[model samples]
Target: MDKITIQNLEVYANHGVFPEETALGQKFLVCAELWTEIRTAGRTDDLEYSINYGTVCQEITRFMKEHTSRLIEAVAEQLAEYLLQTLPLLKGITLEIKKPWAPVGLPLDTVSVKIERCWHRAYVAFGSNMGDRRSHIDSGIQVLRDDPAIRVGSISDMIVTEPYGGVEQEDFLNGCLELETLLTPMELLAVLQKAEQKENRERLVHWGPRTLDMDLLFYDDEVLEEPELAVPHPEIPKRRFVLEPLSQIAPYKMHPVLKKRVKELLEELSDRE
Candidate 1:
């Protein structure tokens, strides 16, 4: 990915924990690296094809001056979100909020918080077996779409399927959704849980009937194994309910670990059944 680096842009802003810092104002520096495609701009020498660093610098200064936050962490996080939303061409942002001359009395260089935030593609599968199944699924989709950081892409048609895990339950309406997000895997999982809770999802039983069930099937071809999250979902190939809809939108999308396409997995699963 191409990048545009803007380093140590000076800004006079009122931001700090101490009242004196905000009242007296202080010098804060911001650095940003915008990830984008600048090849067209380079080839054509056209301003329209590229992001304007001059404009970004101005926006950063204005944003810093306008907002007063106690922590530079908040400042950096908000600034990253702001830039990502404001700059349509940017796929990601590496931001640093630098605070020099602290009141801590300790001799130090600079205190800053740096973060790398980027848009990541994720495939999520959802199902509902309880009341108003379609409504639950649709509401989940709407929640993701409405979030500022999430871009809901292809959504497969809802297909009714028998429940899994040997649990006797109502038929489930299953489907898959594609999303582009700036949230990390765990953060995205929290968001998904929020959507599920909104629909009154329950965990009374394993693979039990619920208002909504959502799983992260894949994330940017990433194979993640964490305490709370797993990418290239552990059961993507075994569950027809998941692969069927997933195949509809991302047939050729490969499983990073398995090295198999969605279509191929769906086919193999079908052959077994």
Candidate 2:
């Protein structure tokens, strides 16, 4: 990834903890490193192929002036998210906000807050075995699509499959989807869970019938094991319902732990049965 750097762009803003500090504005220095591919812009000498630093600088100035936050950390975080969401060309950013007029009694040159933020590719598997299965799945997808931090991409055709857990249940409508999101894994999980709850998903029985079931199958080839969530889904190779749809959309997606493509995992699962 190539970078476009903006150094020491100064702004006068009213962000501070103290009432006096907020009343009287202060000078701040902002620096940004925007990550994107610049080869095409360089080769064609086309500004269209590149992110305009001038426009970005103006946006930063406007954002800082318009929003009032008590902490520089909040400013940096909000600004980074705003730029990444609004700028189509930017893939990632490292932003630094320097506060030169800190009110601490001890003399210091400056206090700064810096952070890195970027989009992550993730796959979510969705299913429903209860009433209006397709509707449940479709509504769940819409919830993800409507989120500003998420960009829903290719969707696999929903398939009807028999329930997996040997518990008596209706066939499930299942599929997987690809998405690019700015939210962390935990945050993403919360969003999915909320969607499920909206559709009246129940956990009365393990692998029991439910109105919706959305699982985080992958997140940028990341392997995660937490108390509430697991990435790569832990059972991808064993669940044909998951792999079948996942393979349709992302056949070449590699598992971080197993180091195999989705199609390969699907094939292996098929062979086992």
Model 1 error, position 197 (Å): 1.5
- TM-scores, all models, native as reference: 0.92, 0.98
The digit string of per-residue lDDT tens for model 1 on 159-186 reads 9999899999899999999999988888
Candidate 2 per-residue lDDT, tens place, 53-165, comes to 99999999999999999999999999999999999999999999999889899999999999999999999999998888888988898899889999999999999999998
Off by over 4 Å in 2: none
Deviation from native of the Cα of residue 5 in model 2, angstroms: 0.2
| lDDT, model 2 | 0.94
Instruction: Give the Cα RMSD of candidate 1.
Output: 1.8
The 10-residue segment of model 1 with minimum total lDDT is: 221-230
Task: For residue 220, give model 2's deviation from the true position in Å.
Answer: 1.1
How big is the positional error of residue 235 in model 2, measured in Å on the Cα after superposition? Answer: 0.8
Candidate 1, backbone clash total: 0
Candidate 2: count of backbone clashes, pairs at least 3 residues apart or interchain? 0
